[model samples]
Target chain A: MALRREEILESARVLFNRWGTAHVSANRIASDAGVSPGNLYYWFPNKAAIIRALFAEWSAASTGVALAGLADSGDPGDALREFVHAAERQPAATARYAFFPRELFALLHADPELAAAYRRNFEAGVDAITTIAQAGIDAGLLIDPAPRANLRDVVVTAWIASECAPAFLEVIAEEPASGRGSGLAGAILRSLLTDEGAKALDERKGARGHEHRGIRAG
Target chain B: MALRREEILESARVLFNRWGTAHVSANRIASDAGVSPGNLYYWFPNKAAIIRALFAEWSAASTGVALAGLADSGDPGDALREFVHAAERQPAATARYAFFPRELFALLHADPELAAAYRRNFEAGVDAITTIAQAGIDAGLLIDPAPRANLRDVVVTAWIASECAPAFLEVIAEEPASGRGSGLAGAILRSLLTDEGAKALDERKGARGHEHRGIRAG
Candidate 1:
């Protein structure tokens, strides 16, 4: 039963990615999953239910894993980069979930329950980034631009900007594929850093470069 | 006839703002407008047409005026601030159009013509900002961060971030009203400015302060 449900979700994700959530139907999802309509119904009551399941799995995989890595990382700057890199690599993992971010507001407005769940996940992600910022401050690697902005707000704003800028620009600007914005997250992060924070980030990048070379040499 | 059309549009905007585009029916909109359904049909054949009209009006009010101002402004820094300030003030002018930014992707996917029109307006807006950036460079008030980052990309990214960040964060984070991120657009713009650009901005801010004081004293 679990295997069958996963199969249905996989099929829905593919279709939803290609045609978007509005155009795809339950029947199409069922057929694509190679399951009888009855069997599909047994696992999922409707198309919305399938979408909810997909979101649940995606939220867990994306935010959940990033939070865990953030908690485990020793370097705050590295953790911040890893978090963004994880989100950046998500497209390769499943381009099918692109609709989630693309239609985020519509989906949330349509489903209050899903919205509530998604909100919790999003908050958790923001909180994780905030923790990293705090860690940077405590380590003397970050300076607070006090009286001007809050550390948490700066970090959250940067994360949201990085995550949404590309998608928003693509939708509104109709930018060419080659013209897609890149490294915006890193740039925003760097802009928020103090001189000390910037130095630390540079050192981390240098260390990572050396590690990459050592691996190749090995 | 024009007055009645405006009345209908006003009514539709109110209801759409309150209930979103999908839930509101033509009948409800007609009744709210105090017009018969026949009259409503005469003006707009369907709900989709009404949405398109709303978008057209919004595009004109929001982007059109800002582009004109950008063209007129002698100072690139002031022009950038004006463009952002105009967009920021729009929520007060008519929060009804919040739906346009909120459901941007979904609306675009559903209506190709609306999408095309919106794309054109968005590109024009970006181009205006790019021109301002070029002017800043020509005046030696802004330095190109070339070999590191593209000025146009940074400006566009900052603009998109500023326009979309507050709404996106509000929706996803369920952030409290008091906890809202403020001055994000200005902060981002400041971050992208060269030292010379930053100094010029500070001097302009000081001049504006004295002008306000002079007006009050008079």
Candidate 2:
């Protein structure tokens, strides 16, 4: 029963990501999952329940592994890379939830419960970035070049740049979401880096050069 | 008859922008416009027709007026401001079409004809930005700091930054769309400016200081 539930969710995610939630129906999800409508309903009472379950998995994946261990590293470059890496790792991780980012407002409008949950997650994401920026400032690894560069504004800029990247990639750049917005987000964040921060980033990049050798697009 | 048509379109735009197209119906539009469902059907036939008319009006407005005179400005800062001004002018102009940007993909997925039209407009916008950036580079007003800063990529960045600003403003920042995304978009573009470009921008800002004095958030 647990395995069947997972299969239903997996099918729904693929269909929703491909055709969007509006176009997909429960029967489609059930058939794609190789289950009868009754079996699918047994697992998820309705489409909304399936969506909520998917969103839960997405929220957990987003918060779990990406920003996990970098906070203790105390190096702003690593922290920044870790932030960019979250985007770089999208294909392997968050890309499964691609439909969420694109359909964010629509989904929120449809589900108040999801909207409240997402707002809390959004605030937490902002706070996490703020913490990282403050640490960077303390370590002399990040500096504000603009006279009125509020850290909050900077964080917001970073947030928009990163969060909106996948949609940007797909729509504007006509690219796949594999690299996500890593290059753009990293460039925007790098603008905030001090000379020392830049040097540290260069050294780190050199060390990881072999790993990211051909992925210059990122 | 033409006046009534405009009223119906105007009413539909407001309702769609406020609540999204999915939630707004033809009957509601006719009621809002103080017309009968029969009259609305006479004017638009269906909700899809209403959306197409709005999209047409939006495309014309977007391609007109704002980028109209700036290409010949010769000053990159002026050119850039004109680009940014397009967003600044949103509350008075394009903000009526706010629903389109936020619901872009969803709308496109629902209507292939609109998708094709949008892709064409998207290309034109990108080309316009590329031309401006190239001119700036030639005139020593813009510089590519990164080794691999392709003009197309920079244009793409600016395009994403500006085009996605309204959604970013409304969704993430929880702000109204009056200023659109001038600040963040301008900052990203400014990161690509040469020293000459920066000085020119400051002088222009000083000259127009009173005009934009309190609206610095843009």
Candidate 3:
């Protein structure tokens, strides 16, 4: 029964990613999972329930991945570089839930429960980002990117850019296949770093390039 | 007949902006407009048609207002300030079609025709922004914010920031009354400006402050 439930969720994710949540029906998800409609209904009372479950799963998974291994880094530039590296390493992490960002507002509007959960997660993410920026400022490795707005504003702006840039880039602008990297987000956040911090980030990038070649040769 | 058509369109805009496009039905739109169902159908064959009509109207209106009066400004700083001012001057211009950005991907996926039209308009907007940035570079008024990325990349990042920031700010982060201005977008774009350009922008801002005070005194 547990395996069947997992199958249903997996099918729903694939279908939602391909055809969007609105276009894909509950029955379609069940059939795609090769499960009977009754079985699917037994697991999830309705489509919204399935969506809520998926969001919960994604949210839980992302919280660990978003700022992993960067908390203890004393150097602001190292923290920023790892932040971008973590993002680049996990394109599939976000891409798996591609439909979410694309229809974020619509999904939130449809399910108030999901909206509440998402709001909590989003606020937490913002706070996490703000803390990182504040640390950088205290260390004098980061400067205020926007002189008028506060640090929270800069964090929110960077948060929004990182969150929405992928969808806009792939869907609207139709940029050529460089969609996997979090370069734009990195660029925005790095703008806040002072010259010394920027040098650290650039040097890290050079090291990463060498590591990639070494791996390829090995 | 024309007046009735306009009424239906206006009602759809209001309801879609409030309740979202997915929740609002054609009958509800007709009822809101005080028009018969048949009359609404006579004007728009389906909900998609109404959405398309609204999008067309918005695209036309935004094109005119987007870069208004900034094209002729010889100073890059002046152009940048005017660009932000144009955005600040017309909150309603984008807010009127608030649902469009929120549900952009869903709407596009549901209707191929609308998606094609939107893509065309979006590409045009990017091109227009790129031209402005290029001019700034030519005049040495702006430097590339992202040294690794090209000018178009910078513009695209700024465009995405401007396009998606409002929705994310209001819906996700729940910021206060400051959602009206395009400050995040202005900040991202202004990052590209050189010291000379930045000075011009700051001076203009100071001047605008004096003007606001004068107007209040009057």
Task: Point to the candidate with the largest DockQ.
Answer: 3
Q: Model 2, range B96-186, lDDT digits (tens) per residue?
A: 7989878876777678777778777767776777666676677786664343334555455545555566665666436421233345555
Local distance difference test scores for all models: 0.66, 0.67, 0.70
What is the lDDT for B23 in model 1?
Answer: 81
Over the full model, what C-alpha lDDT does candidate 1 score relative to the true structure?
0.66
Residue B88 accuracy (lDDT) in model 1: 47
RMSD, model 1, all Cα superposed? 4.8
> Candidate 3 residues A98-179, lDDT tens each?
8887877778866879888988887777676666666666766666544444566556666666667667666664762224
- The C-alpha stretches of model 3 lying farther than 4 A from their native spots are A25-27, A34-43, A137-143, A176-181, A190-195, A209-218, B25-28, B34-45, B137-143, B176-181, B190-195, B209-218
Candidate numbers, best TM-score first, in rank order: 3, 1, 2
lDDT of 2 by residue, A57-143 (tens): 988766543354254455555676565555455435657788887787678767877777766776677677767767777778766
Expressed as tens digits, the lDDT of each residue in B1-33 for candidate 1 is 978788898899888877778889999999999
Cα displacement (Å) at residue B171, model 2: 4.5
Candidate 1's residue-wise lDDT over A1-218, tens digit each?
A: 79999999999998988888889989999999999999999998888899899999878765754485386477665665455446545544434477787777778777878888887876787678668767766766554433334555555556556556545655665452225334554455444556566565555455553633422100
Writing each residue's lDDT as its tens digit, candidate 3 over B3-70 gives 99999999999999998887899999999999999999999999999999999998876654446535
TM-score of 1: 0.78
Interface CA RMSD, all predictions? 3.9, 4.5, 3.2
Docking class of predicted structure 1: acceptable
The segments of candidate 2 whose C-alpha lies over 4 angstroms from its true place after superposition are A26-45, A64-69, A133-145, A148-151, A168-173, A176-187, A190-202, A209-218, B27-46, B61-69, B133-143, B148-151, B168-173, B176-182, B190-199, B209-218
